[model samples]
Target chain A: MAHPQPPESDPQSPSAPTAPAKSPRVGLFVTCLVDMFRPSIGFATLKLLEDAGCTVVVPAAQTCCGQPAFNSGDNKDTRAIATQVIEAFEGLDYVVAPSGSCAGMIREHYPELFADDPAMAQRAQHVAKRTYELTSFLVDVLGVTKVDAAMAGTVTYHDSCSGLRELEVKVQPRRLLAGVSGLSLTELPGAEVCCGFGGTFCVKYPEISDKMVTNKAEEIVATGADTLLAGDLGCLLNMAGKLKRLGAETKVRHVAEVLAGMTDTPAIGDPAASLPNKER
Target chain B: MQSTSRNFKDNAHKALNDATLQRALLNVKSGFQENRARTVAGLPEFERLRDAGRDIKNHVLANLDFYLERFEENVTANGGHVHWCRTPAEAREKILEICKRREAKTVTKGKSMVAEEIGLNDYLEENGVEPIETDLGEYIIQLRHEPPSHIIAPAIHVTREQIAVDFRREHSDLDPNRRLEEPRDFTDEARAKLRDKYFAADVGITGANFLIAETGSTVIVTNEGNGDMTQLLGKAHVVIASLEKIVPTLEDASTILRLLARSATGQEMSVYTSFSTGPRRSEDRDGPEEFHVVLLDNGRSAMLGTEFQDMLRCIRCAACMNHCPVYEAVGGHAYGWVYPGPMGSVLTPSLIGVEEAGHLPNASTFCGRCESVCPMRIPLPKMMRHYRQREFEKGLSPQKARAGLSVWSYVATRPKLYRLATRLASGLLGRLGKVKGRLTTLPLAGGWTSVRDMPAPEGKTFHDLYRDRQAAKGGRE
Candidate 1:
């Protein structure tokens, strides 16, 4: 029942201490999805963190955040993976991930995974206290009000379920997106609803998953936005795939890519038929 | 009643394909979800009220034996007979015995999920006693000989056109060309048909929303006044409820009532909140001559100390289902049980064996929306996961899925091996998808590729790329 306390040097406080002599060391958790499907998100996260005056480290020992195992009722393996992640990201000021889904798995569910073991539970809590979703780390912890980023397009943002519900990452992403020049944000209808890419759930119940993502795709296309952005790769992939299957032209990318002004790469699910086009 | 829960996948497939059901399911979002959101926003204390409601249920559950005993004593003292039935069969037989004692030919019922849980109507028909459903939604589904789909809105899956067709087919004595285009028109017709049945019935059965342990009063909240007429007009009144329905006091019942209406139908209060104490008094003008309360255990007692005990706090509001995307997509019937949606996913597996209803728990995205909107703060997804854990432990999960998970875990546990495997897989997939940037087909991923393409990886793992970046920077700083 103990509440996790915020770090001592509260950046948002009016009387907050000035920048410390040493830069805050950040351990970037390159989520498995971002690591495999789109390493650009990982690079974008690195740029965002480094630009915010922090020293960033990519911990190679970390792979998945143990979410796939945790959600599948395989707690034994989840524990093993979580232990590896904890050991890998030890001694960092913050463990930031480009994904709310993976960050939430570490921040929220890790402690719960080790509830029965007090020793490991303490370690999990320590790691959890330092873990944060990327946008939240930028806006909330770093007091980032604006970003030196620009992207041209009317864009809509889908609030991934874990980020919005689990970590309260609704406004932090939007707070940063509002600062991006030349970007008009059209709010997605039912933005807080899940995109149905529930890790393995999409395949387990593909029919149901299709219906949900199909509805999401319709709403995204209805916005007439040229691009779609979300914080988590899982949801972006799901929506992007469905949008492609339906032959819709709305591009998809991780929110970090747009926030870091890193949209030079082709949008997710877009064919590599055309050369990379920089929006700015 | 009869569980097709074992065939949940097939049921969900059928539900997904049924266009009419799909269209009707849309109303759940605009109707219940939006209304509840607006209503809860208007009331600032709704969250605190939820907390209060949860604490009260937790307290009552902790002393469930004491409260239930007190409830029975109060009911007996109020000139009411309390029947303690351990199983659904016992509860059904007890009600049938009371009906036979009165020599009842027909009985009218108000909306009671417990009745549906016990399959009262089918049992009554087999015993030569006709059970007439008086609630509009209940009556419609009953006429079709179909079980209720959504709990609060029993016939929610049925469109107006379907209901009109059903009415014409069943009520052959009525005019075949009656206009039932409007909701009021359907309700008016149903009212007229059910009016006489209320007075003609020898026994009336109603589900108690809350059984006050303090006063022995059985409370029911209904938009329609049929519950009042059914209980008062019959010669004998029987209240069928589960043991968990007992609350410590009337005040506690009122606190839960504040949440039930807003959560269930977005009303500040139900139009009719009736509380019946025992039967008729000696000086009472018009009421049932005899009163009986049947408390069925039906696996609820076993749940008291288990992980699913929070399920007992459910007030049958259906808020969880209203906000659930999975439930929204497939509708209620696909859950293939008496109770459906998120609550049903947890409760069904517990009430029925988990072996029979394993699919119910597994068929969720775990979006956490159900738990977010739940009035009782039930950790529905957590409980569902617990059911999954049980299935895994019991080897009830599919062998293929288990094998796949094992292979995934085996590699995932070894960071070096995981890196190598993901690097190779991403490299192959990225190469295959070089042209389109996505793969339309892949081996062992037919479920995914059947409806949508799989976006290819960026050809290299982040670990590999980051390591190279570090090497270019001349080692770790």
Candidate 2:
């Protein structure tokens, strides 16, 4: 596991010529949903970060970020799972996640989880400060606008509710994708609109959920894009499920997967067969 | 006289029958949402702007009384008058008195929702004063004698064809043989007619987007330029609005304006961003002779300390309604109130008691999309839940729903009983599932079955499957 370090420039020194330190160690907090259900995203994050010349590590003990429980008002279960997560990744130069919902849980609510304990709150803040969405981590911290990853397809991005609103993860991803050699970033009509996958909301109220996802699917098809890209796996899965059910051929892939040169490996199950034709 | 409430089934039935309204709604299905996203994408610091917008509203709301006093003083200092009204009747009376004093006969209004809340047009009409709606959307709804379906786009439920018919019937002076061919044609005709009213009217009534305390200016943003022309050409200009519209400084106003335009219409700025500081400066030749600001309280001052204080952060963007599935299904009129959509679901019940609007809260699937897109970042779903709880506590929900909820609550308190009940129900449902894979309708669950099919439950519940699987795997059983 990697631990995020303080910037090398001295806080005490008023005037000093400072050299930007070597790319700090960054551990990919591949969310539990992506790790268990969508392993390609994890591999993509690793490839993208490593390609950028940074030390990368994947902490094995990282589980669910307790978002499912927290959103359900089960504070106790959320705290229990969150504690396990913090303990597992106690030292990391930067704990980064590809999903906006997981990143928000780590950054926004982790402090509340440890509100009773001051030391735990401080530790949670440390993790929160270092944790960044995949695109934000790459663009803001690493200052890398372009990556070697290339693919050919028209893609529109879905702004996951947590990422777009909670963490403001809109531009960083677009900037990175814009720099990619051949990919075209088309705007989905109502792209900032929620896909209506409110975690438990999809199950509890499936009727209304059906209407929302169907609307989203219609909008995605309207964009005339062959692929859908988003930072959060939850939104992608919801959209993908709807698209598949509707028999639409639009494929869903995490933004990290597209940027990591993993397009050659088919995203769903076959890594070798998934690569773009040019890469293969 | 509480005609505001409608039975949930009745509202849905009414909306379903309105084919013309559905056509109109389809035209604007994702209109605002697309525009807002496009506008936000253009600004690099959009999120920072949103945060600042939220903070500014929060600050003004916290010190509302002080700001109101300061605004009142500034308006008075600028040769303008400020009238404080605690109720709708007071607001109506104040406006009437001002009209009576000025001996104003014909008045032109520039699309004010606050005016609708006070029944201002009706009051003026009873007193023999004519009020004309200037905005194209508002004009159609006015001619048709209907309340605004959507707040900003008042006559959103009326189709272009319907408007053409309305204009033909009302504008008898037009050629009876000529056909209304296009929207541009209808708009040009309306523009020609409304231009006359803009100049001929003695007073112009408009709503303020924000009341700036620093310079005592009332800011109005309009795309059609009606608000600008109304204030600039009329003899007297009146702003009958809420106290929550007051902001402390122009900088804060600009920050809000940045978010408001993008959030509402996806415009970098409205076509006419008119700031009327006490009607017009003395040197200004073409401006109203008298200016009046009516700070309306009605039920807002009481909401300041309540759970709904966050609602005051709303800039009337209607982004929530645009993305809401329920709003898409039933349209705005089904809410049976001035405001509609997620914001309306929470607000309608608050303003008109729980008994009158018990169904509004349940109208949502609790999708939480409204909260996500809200520039102010209000927790809309939770506030809606508060309304739902209030309705349930007051015994406003239907008897069957209440009974069903009680049964579930009883089962929830006892885990063993819950498992038994679920197991028995699922087994019966599984047997029924063999006949057809789903139930098209269910007795006593008319609301759920009306819109969709209920999938047949599996023979075993999650608890039962979890226990059996764990035992097979040599884990906890």
Candidate 3:
């Protein structure tokens, strides 16, 4: 498979209005963790894309991408999950997810997940090529840095592990945030480190998970940002929980919700009341 | 030989307190990681090569005995002796016998991890042989009476300032007033000291990177060319290599070498790639008169057909160690074994027994950086989990941790009970927060609460929230 010219450099970003537009249909793959807990991330994803001049569609048939079961050595459940996901977004113009962990499941892992079946491997490869994380698609494919959506607040971005390592989703979100008027992007130290939210890993090894997220929260607080922004809701929720428990004055917001200017309500928490406590 | 792991806690205490060593380790740690990343990023097909490399290693490991015998035949046909040892005792005996037969007083050696495994240097010294480590990094550790902190860069825990002091004490003949500030100065001083040992030593010892079965060639990759000098000029040459070092063909060796150097020093290839087929070939201009290959099984063959067979595929690129966050925080010496980092976490337990190195596997956050950057693509974090599983199965886990896990397992298996327990736990913890939403103490989770306030759960568990949301959305629409 050829490496896609990143959406930022593609002819699509600047001249997307004049260029012949391909099918605008996008199948939003609401990842299992997000679907079960943070449904607002799904709606924010829809609003962000539709606002960016794309015809967004949520394939309700989508279920978990089967990464959890697959990585845990349960091939039976993984295949069951993969079969459900493949059927959900089969023949779509593009399959997009708000989570890099899930997109990596579809893009990098799905083919390996079905190596025993040649037909499924081919189908997985196709899906892997078209699938993009929301920010990668927004800045790279849609070529829109600013969503014409604006919010006045200091926000620090957490680079999710899968998104940063697997999909290189660091700069695209940063680029889009830089273009947003009145949005101050505060850089968090050791931003590339994992937030200890490895799906089931949080519950499986909660002690270590708590240590990692607590470290991440301390870094987020050090930035003195009012809100913590990240591409993946899994990390945001984990960070948010820690932030809330510490009574940290900072709110946790998804990059999509910020880019879409939908930060008025508490999707995760209230942004205005966020203040760093000395106890932290 | 010696169980350094038994002295781990004391060694770790010393390692933790030695500010000078810590300073040196911090400087060298990220340098290697950065170089490796830059090198791998240059090769577009590096990841594909990694997969292929892993497959090749898997294939070789599955047919190890056949490959070992084939390698032995090839080495013997090319005028080299092949001695196989099933245990460390046999390996030590064979090497000592060879050294005694040569009547060697001094032995110059290249960097060999396997030698360290067998405790060859200490054994040689005890048997009236003075072993001189020719590798600059190895030589530094020898002077300090310390084992290597890193596999490739021995004495990586020592900085240049410490090296200057070591050189001044070890080589008192050198100009005392001479200022040595640059890396080049240290390299040159070590080289000048070791060059005489290379020529005067009766025996030369080095490690084999790969034993080519088809060519009977023992390949060694090094930056300093010290291994070549040790083997080429010495009267008797001994290659102390592990059983897993054999490859079926030179092509396979090249494939592994391509990834090895790139993964290691981030070079497309190391400065020197030497292939020695046999006793320097009779007609060769410069070579050893007698060549011996001491193949040590040392519990490696037991790994065959086991869950750890993939571990044998490790080319010792040190990528896993370089990328590991835990390894960065507590340097390799803290691991309390010959190998360190993610690979060491899995390997030391298997080779040295889990009871000895059980804490090594637990010393991880399961961050998965090691797996991502691994050139051989070893699923290191998952493998660590397998060791953790073994600890639990063998009842080796601490009673407190075991009880904690038992309770967790019970809760994890029952969703309704789990939710009820979590709800009550979070609610109680939430209400106990003092001083504007912070809990300074907790009974059960004091390990967490001691360091940072345990995050209160967001009122409802995901399961509870989902149930309510589904009901509100008209029974899932």
The TM-scores, one per candidate, come to 0.97, 0.70, 0.77
Query: Model 1: what TM-score for its first chain?
Result: 0.92
Q: Against the true structure, whose lDDT is highest?
A: 1
User: What's the lDDT of the predicted structure labeled candidate 1?
Assistant: 0.90
Model 1 ranges off by over 4 Å: A1-20, A276-280
Q: DockQ numbers for every candidate?
A: 0.72, 0.07, 0.11
Ranking according to DockQ, highest score first: 1, 3, 2
Where does model 2 exceed 4 Å of error? A1-280, B1-3, B176-179, B279-282, B435-446, B475-477
Candidate that scores best on TM-score:
1
Candidate 3 TM-score versus the reference: 0.77
Candidate 3 runs further than 4 Å off: A1-149, A153-156, A162-181, A184-190, A195-228, A231-280, B1-18, B434-437, B458-477
Over A81-128, each residue of candidate 1 has an lDDT whose tens digit, in order, gives 999999998767789999888998999999999999999999999889
Candidate 2 chain B has its poorest 10 consecutive residues by lDDT at B447-456
Ten residues in sequence with the least summed lDDT for candidate 2 chain A: A10-19
Cα-lDDT of candidate 2: 0.74
* List of clashing residue pairs for candidate 1: none
By summed lDDT, the worst window of 10 consecutive residues in model 1 chain B runs over B169-178
State the displacement of the C-alpha of residue B274, model 1, in Å, after optimal TM-score superposition: 0.7
Task: Report the CAPRI category for model 2.
Answer: incorrect
